[model samples]
Target: MNENVSFYRDTWAEINLDAIEYNVKSMVEHLGGEGTVIAVVKANAYGHGDYEVACAALEAGADMLAVAFVDEAISLREKGMKVPILVLGASRPEDVQVSIDYDITLTAISLEWVKKAEQFAKEGVLQFHIKLDTGMGRLGITEKEELDELIQFAADSSSLSVRGIFTHFAAADELESDYTDCQFAAFKKLLGGISNKEWLIHCANSAAGLRFKDRIFNTVRLGIAMYGLSPSKEMNKELPYSLQEALSLHTKIVHVKKLPKGGKVSYGATYTAQEDEWIGTLPVGYADGWLRQLKESEVIAGGKRVQIIGRICMDQCMIRLPEKMPEGTKVTLIGRQAEEYIPIDEIADRLETINYEIPCILSARVPRMFLRNKSIMEVRNPIIQSHSASKG
Candidate 1:
């Protein structure tokens, strides 16, 4: 299945494309004909593999794809993604031509950005979605006067085409946020000036989409929830339906050794065997996104959970095996093995971070093996590709 590049490492992330499709379909069903779903495949689909996840989302009836910036949109375009790709972040006014050339939609956060972009819009239609800063305080028009000027300018420009207007909630993850209520009220007041009611209006991210159906106007941006992750731990209880997690981290035990009683393991000699114990070396470490902070974490081996012992090295770590497991035995850093399972949330807990940050932090050196219909669909090995490109 992995014929293109011979993988030289034992550790890789397995991405289930079916799970991605399932999550999208679940969201579509949850919306129940309420609005269009905008699949947020930014940060390489939260590091699940962008192109692969985008294709899966589209296949599951996502109306459009959203990315954080223009380069991300361009990457999807380069991969032949034909569906509408919206750049949710601010872009340089000079980059207007590139968006037009690639058929990517740009976000107009302010009149200043719009006027600067107008200079670059010598020719070709440039589509835009006006962003309103209701409560996020990140970008967009905060006042009615700014909104009116931006709308009027776009309506007057020969090259500019304003397709939509939207805002973001600062605390949609919290079900009881008075701030979210005020933000929606502000967004509605701003919407009063715009005559075009058909413009794609959206104000809901994953959390809002799942909890507040009234706020999701015509479109919902599915980001964290699209990857089968809850928008926040607190919102997990309110999920209308269950989501299928798609990624699993795996590696193989490369070396096994018997540690004498009181013998130490790894660089700092932090882990000592109270009794004679079997230790297995895994070819995964901090350099591969397996941070040293996870040295105390447990991994699934031989159908049981085993502790990762010692200070995690740059390229390797040691685990205390229950017995003398043979070299090349399977080890699951994340996912199910027999009855034992290690969710990404557990890894996140150990690192004192969110589950969304886990996969995004996985280094490029780790290959992503995409699975579809329970078979290997494709393998993306950046290391091998770089090597091949250098030789060429």
Candidate 2:
């Protein structure tokens, strides 16, 4: 247990703020002022570091910031971000005043929770939005009678302010248009428009944002796409604007060993040397979000592509380097190097998941070095990467 030996090696994720602005510009250009994009910075801005991504997004003209919880909003607030933050998900009733103290808006569908919030709010003022369950069947007011009263109360309340009305699309990105249209129609019927209070009404997520321009809600919740990634494969195909992958995972080779053709590598001897080859160990692994499912995957090393040999370990993974490169060489798990690039989507596709999880999973233990214009712009505080995170 050496004091300075970092358990993580072999891979790390890179994020570029410059590309973030580009992605925001792409979406705004495609929108052409049809609607406002409320950038979703929840889940630590989808694992790209919430404050940094949120700052970058605001730099690119994102109108508002949305999060899934109160603490996240509080974090952005702590960073001195003066932009409006709307908690798009759960906010415990006990913490309503804390939310108010931070000037954050909480989402409420239950009259009970609203009443609780009203109790805690100072000056009887609690700015919050009501989430409607159009079809997602998630957290939101679903019953008609409840929704009507909630709307009326919001309109009449002196203590509560209805900042906006919104809903989620269950299938906005699918080619099958039936479900999306249904959700939209349901949301429209529920919110014909509130009188007296001119709140911004928005309901389009990334998928709905790109398609159904005529059906544009008052505001769009731009999540995955805002970070230069898409919600689904089909949407990527139909994207009206070119998207750049804002987050890149990179690391350097710290240790290289030349193994004979018969050498066994990693757990289970899953990978045997294919002739005499160079095996290099990176300083990070599945613990850092380099999923073990990518056991047979490849990472860009020394300007050339190399394969991850054997089962990915918990704190580190091994890649086979070429004779031209050795210890101390840089390996690219997500970004570009010379003529080769490993987009995050490729890894997601390889693992049968969405690209959103890649950066999020790169535990906080691995440091995120932010880049702007291809140079180190800033290094975020150390990621809380959990090594005990079930081994890769």
In order, candidate lDDTs are 0.91, 0.80
> What TM-score quantifies how close candidate 1 is to the native fold?
0.97
Among these predicted structures, which one has the highest TM-score?
Answer: 1
List pairs with backbone clashes in candidate 1: none
What C-alpha RMSD separates each model from the true structure? 1.3, 4.5
Model 1 agreement with the true structure over 118-224: per-residue lDDT tens digits: 99987798999999999899999998998898888888989999999999988998876789999999999999856786789999999889998889989999999
Q: What tens-digit string does per-residue lDDT give for candidate 2 at 307-347?
A: 88889898788887777466778788887999998888899
Please list the residue runs of candidate 1 whose C-alpha ends up more than 4 Å from where it truly belongs after superposition. 1-5
TM-score, per-candidate, Cα-based:
0.97, 0.92
lDDT of 1: 0.91
Using lDDT as the measure, the top candidate is 1
